[model samples]
Target: MPTILHRRWLVGGAALLILLALTAGYIFLTTAATAPARARIQAAASMRPFGEVDQEVVNARTLVEDTPESARAWSVLGLAYLQLARETADPTNYGRADEAFQRALDLDAASVDALIGAGTLALARHEFAEALELGTRAMELNPTIPRVYGVIADAQVELGRYEEAVASVQTMVDLRPDLASYSRVAYLREIHGDNQGAIDALELAVSAGGPAAENTEYVRVQLGHLYFATGDLARAEQIYGESLARLPEYIPALDGLARVRAARGEYSEAIELYEQASARIPLPGTIIALGETYEAAGDQGRATDEYQLVEAIQLLFEANGVRSDVELAAFSAAHGDDADRALALARDAHVRLPTIFAADVLAWSLYRTGAIAEAAGVADEALRLGTQNSVMLYHGGVIAAADGDTDTARTRLEAALDLNPRFSPLLADRAAAALAALDN
Candidate 1:
């Protein structure tokens, strides 16, 4: 039996010891739980530039799957899957990424990383509404998350909500100030008739070192396009050359260089560059550019050949379940000397797409074959789509002028110039001539 004072001392000492043990144990558990999350964050940050890290990501995914209790682990797994999808462009990878993100959401419904990754995948698939919803949710969950705004910007761009895209990208730049956000914003500026603004934004993008080589190359190519659009062909040529120096196989740079050369009346040089680009990508845009270059060079035979190749590719694409009616109509109308074939292709495309661009092509094909009335009808239908596209407006104006509707022709031609003041010199010259003819 201890004395009263001695027993009080003994009890106080035991309680102090218990408190110290509990504090030490809590610190140890917290650190143990957080170590893996910190490591995963470090790994993800390191793997951003190396797009070909699919195998490493798969291993990370396995680790996360094994750790069912860790929300951060699921985020790591989702990010890995997203990276794999970006590298492979396999939609299945996106599906897997979505599943991983969904698991993360289940674990922690407010996970910002999961929302951003899921939104990004939706954007890549052109599911704009889903992307917007997910991106908005991500921002709501964590307003500080820069990638959430990036997802929103991409979805806005795909939906042709350029103004909203610009605002979202601006917010992303404000937060993280990364090259991707700047590049996208610059492109939107260019589309909105702010050529200098685009150049400034792209300069910032080039200065920002976070963009990978491929992304930097793309930015340079876009810079060249902006310069070309602003009639600074020399600067455009220099930028394209720089891009090519950085990535010799960059097809967009080659195409940009070809356009600049063609503008400078170096048709043969332009034709060579266009040919190289076409050989590399074989895309409809590249093919069309090559044909146009050849046509500028007065080499109708080569131009016809390029257009025929485009038609062949379009047919192959269609056979492979890829609808390319708009491209097919464009190539056929411009290069198919057989009016009947051009009209047939254009009609089929109009029936399929029914958009302003498709309708414009159908109208142009009809006009080429001297069917003014039908062309006018189709062009009018195109105008109802409410897209103030310069090219479409120009086509409609031409059709109306051909049909002796001087008032409508003047209105549309003026609208085209208002929409795109630098709308191709050829089209502008035609518009001017039509207006002069009306006056006379």
Candidate 2:
């Protein structure tokens, strides 16, 4: 937990101290920017993965300096800073983005570009209500823009307004049936228990291409994740490999392949890929996966180190005004440590953003803290949409078992294994064991 010890755990000898933040925001291609702004970003950014946005940021800054009075230039700079923040996982970039957007708004209060930029930044920062307001304003300014609907739909989804989110996504798709819209459709379908429908839409996204190579590859990673969720390890591995071939060492692809390897019990390979990914961006999810892989491989010491790093990173993000309460709560519940803390964090998250994910975490945390009846009730709400998420089903099964509902417990547990036998690197075997005990 000391500074020196943290330094020792750095992947590939990099400092790895600051949270290279993972983006939890929805995806947008941003194809509606001004010609100069788009050209500058596309030329400087090119097809080189989203994690490398330094050149794009530099180009945007130069343009801003060249045309200091142009609100569009300032908006582009703001967007560039926002992209840099997302790719680098550095919350400090968010501050720079905020300043640039404010400057743009000051110059032109009706700048849709600035509004969209600021709205997307809010999404990245997990301020769903603020993002919704900004997106709505942008939509009112230009209802025909697909990206505006993307922002609105993303915020609505996080705010637990599923029907509204669906309508927004439909509008986006009707306006522009491209990678961004199709991908959103895929997510909505997946969450609504239509796995095959999700896959079909993702395939459309893959074929539709994207604004950048990374965008296409990100969709591939998502496709791979869908397969991975269904226990189709072979297909998932193949898609991940294809993505890597297109964009070598793409973080999400590496993470996906690592997950496949872990599911297949190839811990060394999984750890190596995860190390590569965490070295580049250090997403909290990837770090946790690496830690869980280490734990699976019988390296408890290293696993503990990774877990400690996650805690440190979460604390750092909090200090920077990014709320990671749900993530932290899930981590605590999974690790079976500090159940009370997990419950409180989950409660806070559910109150702020009542998404199904928040509901699931809250339910799990409640179960961890021994509030079985409340946990069961909340778990039902988590699955109210009939989402086929194995982990949520697993949680429901466990909670039902605790409440002595043998039939429901058996049905839920069976459904979870049917969906994905290896739904979690750390918990899948436990689920099997629990199911076996119930049978006996």
Candidate 3:
């Protein structure tokens, strides 16, 4: 087998004159009144450049300073910190966010905004059960709040509670058919193999988002991803280019474009983009992608360094109480010396919550450890939603082939190659070889 590298706004207005300025101020005040402080925070946090994120953090801090007893101000500060953390990939910001959320709760224990913020932070930390509990409580506090449903839906999705997630997201879209709601719908549809439906939802998401906001660019990238999954590389490339035009530093867009380049066998161009993407967001996945590119180019030393970087980052995350279970398990299954340890870690991760991603790792690990029957079961879970991921299908196909499921293996491997012929330099070559063997 060959290598595997598949990865995955606010407006401000100025007043014309003093009266115009006052009128704008009055408008903001009235809007804030109806929108709630958290909504306003979310809007500001989602839109514009990092300048706006910084400004919001400052503004929230000032508000809390002026009114220490105001739970809303504290919650707003917490959310701004969280947003900053997301943009910068700085885990320290999460600590600051934690304090801000707790402070908000201290001021007002039943504050739904604070609860939701905390829940979201938990989700980021991969504490799915905790996130769900916090989300559930926040929902009980206010059922009509759209964002609360989103938090709960996200938690459910991570926990493999797809039916519940679908129901929750339906309510979310019904209440507010905006970017957040439409994006969630897009992903659910994609997972369910409804490619057309996914594309339709993402288009709505793009339309619902304002140009000034980064969310608009984000949705554009999602639309590109749907196109990519359908093997429409030209459309995917076009959409990704559009997204980068608006949000030049968006890591996901950079990574998506990098993958597109790699799939076309543009190794040098792919390497350049992957480097830029990894520098901005050195997550395990991005690093892994970079490693695959290096390996494809026969730069074994650099590839080894990238793998070490992933391990170091995983350790750092674990130390910070952030569970990197899926990444850790996947990495171990692929690279760990001890097959038993790899299988155990994967199994443990799956037991916590069988996310489709976790299930894929578990299947790979089980196969590695020669637990063929269990691997088959785990593979079923991985493909349950019909996710069109080349690496996942490749792994599943190889596993099934080892277990004497030639028919299933051929179907999956063929689908992977059809989806993206150059999905992984190693895996693609491997898939072709496997299919040839099965035919013989």
Q: Per-residue lDDT for 184 in model 1?
A: 63
Task: Indicate whether candidate 1 or candidate 2 has the larger lDDT.
Answer: 2
Go through the candidates in order and give each one's C-alpha lDDT: 0.65, 0.78, 0.74
Order by TM-score, highest first:
2, 3, 1
TM-score per candidate: 0.61, 0.88, 0.86
Residues 5-86, candidate 3: write the lDDT tens digits: 1001111110000010000001112222233322323443445454677888999999999999999999999988877766
**Per-residue lDDT tens digits of candidate 1, residues 1-440?**
43111212111000000000000001111134344323332343343444345666867768886898777787777777655544332334555667777888898888888787777666554445788999999899788877787778766655546567656766676676656666666655544545566677777777774434655666677777777765677788899999889877566788888887776678788788887765534455776777877776678798777666555544434433444455667777866778888899888876654555677889999999999999999998777634555677788988999999989999988877665454452355666676677778
Residue 295 in candidate 2 has what lDDT?
Answer: 98
Superposed model 3: Cα runs more than 4 Å off: 1-50, 210-212
Give the best candidate by lDDT.
2
Q: Could you tell me how far off, in angstroms, the CA of residue 88 lies in candidate 2 after the best superposition?
A: 2.3
Q: Write candidate 2's Cα lDDT for 1-440 as tens digits.
A: 32111222111110001122443332212333223222322343343454456777888899998999999999989888876665555555787888899999999988999998888888777777998999999999999888888888888888889889877877787677778777777777778887877777778788887765766777888889999998899999999999999988778889999999898889999999998887766667888999999999999999988887676566545544566656777887787478888888889989988989899999999998889999999999999988988889899999999999989888889989998898777788888988998988
Residue 364, model 2: lDDT of 92
